[model samples]
Target: MLLIDLDRFKPVNDLYGHAAGNAVLCAVADHLEDLLPVNGIAARLGGDEFALLVPFTGGIENLKRLAQQVITSLVAPISWNGGAVKVGATIGIALIAAESDADTVLHAADLAMYQGKREGRGTYRVFEDSMDTELRERAALEAELREAIEHGAIEPFYQPVVSLPQRDCVGLEVLARWRHPTRGLLGPDQFIPIAEETGMIADLSYHLLRQACLDARSWPSHLLLAINIAPQQFQDRDLAQRILAILAETGLSPRRLEVEITETALVQDLEAARTTLTSLQNLGVRIALDDFGTGYSSLYHLRELKFDKLKIDRSYVDTITMSEERAKLVDAIIKLGSSLGLVTTAEGIETDASVAWLSGQGCNFGQGYLFGKPMPKGEVMRMLQAGPRLEQIGISSMPESRIHAVPMEAIIHCGVGRAA
Candidate 1:
């Protein structure tokens, strides 16, 4: 039995449409049949996946040759409309071992196919027992994430976004933290990719967005709540409408909410993302390009999208003090934002020296450990009630100070002054 999976198939479905996707899948089936042996049969399992079965008790060399032919024939581009649709094949082979039943053989082949995918597509793998362990671990993580979302165990930890020089907490970024029962606490780095692959990202994002909005309602209307948007989450047609609903239900003003999405999200389908942002902006919401300088088309997106903020990624910030070239790049980014009338935010400012340097550059805002790590809502409220002074970030009376928008500190306690 040979199981084949098409690579780069989703992009075709996403960029083109189901009609294009179906045409490609049908072309693959035809290619498989044309290359099949006399008694060989090919069937499409689902989506862009196909299966080929042949009764062959010959040497492994013949089976290997057949697999190579299958890949070569399937890799050719298929005509869809006036354009060409391209996808590569990843194949897995399973031979009838001594005691291997139909189900067992099929399972083995599927595991090998996935291994082929991991090794990079356009390859093939023979069945092995080791792949099962990795698959099981992935399955377990997905199960935990589903349960956590259902039980509302995922909490939003708010980190302060401090206005530079002035050091006032003008905003808080809502970060997701999973309160796993056995694992204590888990960061997004650990489970977010799994959630995205398992199709739980939309559910997870909506859950957190709603909770973050509700939590921010108690803050002063002048303060903003920023949240990250996953790349796949933008593909949803109702994304903007859903955000407006969450804002209304949480009693948070649309103007006080800032949506942060990476430049890569806009690269998928520029037109679609434009519409989503335009709709959100129509609701009086603000848009920010998060993690700048990471994606392929950052400048193009910037030119096209009317973003209100440009967040300098931490990678660039980390090298500012050490590398002269990097320092110049950082300066240019800040200046670029200023020229465009955008709020330039320096992320991951860990040291007092970086903070001091950023303030000197006339940077608009900064966020990182120097400001404060993400904290519970109760802690944030207490800090707010204490007052807007942000001396806790170790920025007490700088050598030179110039007042900016609001006289607040880098701490979450922005002296929201709306009462505890």
Candidate 2:
């Protein structure tokens, strides 16, 4: 049995409407029908996933070759509604070995498919016994995530965003934390992708939104709160209405809440994403292009989406001081955001040099451990009550003024005494 997953399916579904998504599905099914033998069965397993039951009479290499053929065939874009959509599939094969039942075969093939996804998709994997443990652990994590939501085990942690020009905390980004009761605090990387894969992201998103809105309501009125959105949640027709309702219930102004979405998430279906973004914008919520510069389509999206803010990805921020290329990229991004009249925030500002560099480049805002790490809501509340620590300084006051402000004599005297 061979199972194929359209790895890039979500973008197609998100960019086009479900109707166009259905068309792509039908097209894929038609292709499979044409390629499979008379006894083979091809079935839709819903939402960009398909299953193919092929008789186990062939060698594994033959199945791999077939998968490659399917991938190559799909390289051509599918025409739908006056536009073309491009996508690819990853296939997993499990030969019906002796003593293998349907469940075991399916499980093995599913693991193989995931292996393909890990290797960058558009490929295939044959079942191996070693994958069984990892698959089971993932299944367990998925189950645990569902329970975590029910038991209120997932909590919101706030990471502060500092205004570089003012050196004062202006807002907080609400990040999800999974407290496993026994496993201590777990980051989103541990279970979020599984949540998205299993279609639990919508529920988790709403839960976080409600919690974040409630927390922000208690904070001082001037401070803003930003929350991340999974692309899957955008599929809901009433997402804008739901967000507005949450704001109303929490007594928080829509303007105080910012929604951060990845560039990859928005480029999947430009038209549908535009419609959703327009709806959210009408609700008075600010939208930011989170993790910018990581995707191939960031520049194209910036022009198309007209986002309120641009968040520079950490990969560039981390090495900005060491690499002239990275520094130039940051400078260009800051200039781009300024020209577009959008606020730009750099993430992963861990050192004073990096912070100074960003400020010198005219970047307006930043978030990173150098400012404050992600902490629980109660801790965030306490910190907010403590008020802003450093005063905000302008771009002209950076590097030179900062250096002049420090006592150079003290450093010289300390070095002299140590050398003696």
Candidate 3:
């Protein structure tokens, strides 16, 4: 059995139309039928994908030869109303072993086809044991994750965002944690991609955001709650309205609630993004561009839309002390934020020197492992209670701007309790 995917087929539909795309697919079917053996069965497994089953009693070399022939045949340009349509097929071969079942064999062939595409299109790859096992494990994990969301196992854990030089705990970044029944606790890095792939990311994010708001509603007004929003969530036309409802239900003040948008989210649909973000701002809630430099369109986003803050990505911050160029880049980013009036935050502030250097550069905020890891509500509450006390600041810890950053020791002492 061989699986084939037609490359560049989408361009025909985009450049021409679906009618032309269908014509190209039909041409591929014709080519497959012509190339396959007399006893072979050629099946159109839906748009631009075809499969062939050839009963072979010979060695693997024969299948290789047949795959190459199919590739050669597909490479020939098809005349569609006198316009030449060109495409190539990536082939994946799955040989039937003694105990192979129909579904398993087809899955192996599908994996092999993708492998060929990854290795480079217009080539063929044979399925390997590891590939099949990995695919099956991923599928199983996806199913488990879907069940976890329904069971309310995914929830928010927060990491603090501290004020620079002063090191005051000004806010917390809400992060999702999956309290899996069998797997203990799993962080976003472990399950977020699966959630995104399964189309459950929106649900997961909303659940966390609403819960975080409810939890933080009673916190001191000065301590903001930042929720990370995914790009997928913005596809909904009523995203802003839905957030309004969440705020209303939780009684969390919009002023103290910050929504952080990653670069990936902003670049997805600029018009929709601008409208949604503008609506969000209209509600008096602050917005921050999260992981600033990594997105596709930073300059355009800054120019066309408004942001309350810019969180510098960790990549640049990590190299500040190690490389002069990186240090200068960080300096420039801080300066840009200052000029544009965006509250600049240095993300991933790991060492004391980095914190000192960022403060010297006039970064407004800092977040990283040096301050704290993402923890449960109770632990965060304790840390919040420990605010700007000299003990929390290590009694003598001071930045170069310690005189100007007068609130460093006292501000970390801000306390939070249940609303009475």
Specify the highest-TM-score model's number: 2
Evaluate model 1: give its TM-score. 0.70
Candidate 1 off by > 4 Å: 1-131, 392-420
lDDT, candidates in the order shown: 0.76, 0.73, 0.75
Summarize candidate 1's per-residue lDDT along 1-420 as a digit string, tens digits: 999989878767766788998898889888998988888888988878888888775777777888899999878889999989788899999887778798998899999998887677898898777788888987988898899988787777766677777666666666678888788888876778677778787788888878877777776656666567777877898889988888888887777777888766776667888999999999877788877887655787888889988889888897788888888888888988989998788888887778788778768888787766776777666656655455535422232211223522222212110011
lDDT of 1 at 105: 87
- Candidate 1, residue 360: lDDT: 80
List candidate 3 segments past 4 Å from native: 1-106, 109-127, 390-420
Worst 10 residues of 2 by lDDT: 411-420
- On the 0 to 100 scale, the lDDT of residue 367 in model 3 is 73
Task: Return the clash pairs for model 3, or none.
Answer: 387-412, 387-413, 388-409, 388-412, 388-413
Predicted structure 2: clash tally: 4
TM-score of 2: 0.74
Q: Alpha carbon lDDT of residue 73, candidate 1?
A: 86
| CA shift of 177, model 1, Å | 0.8
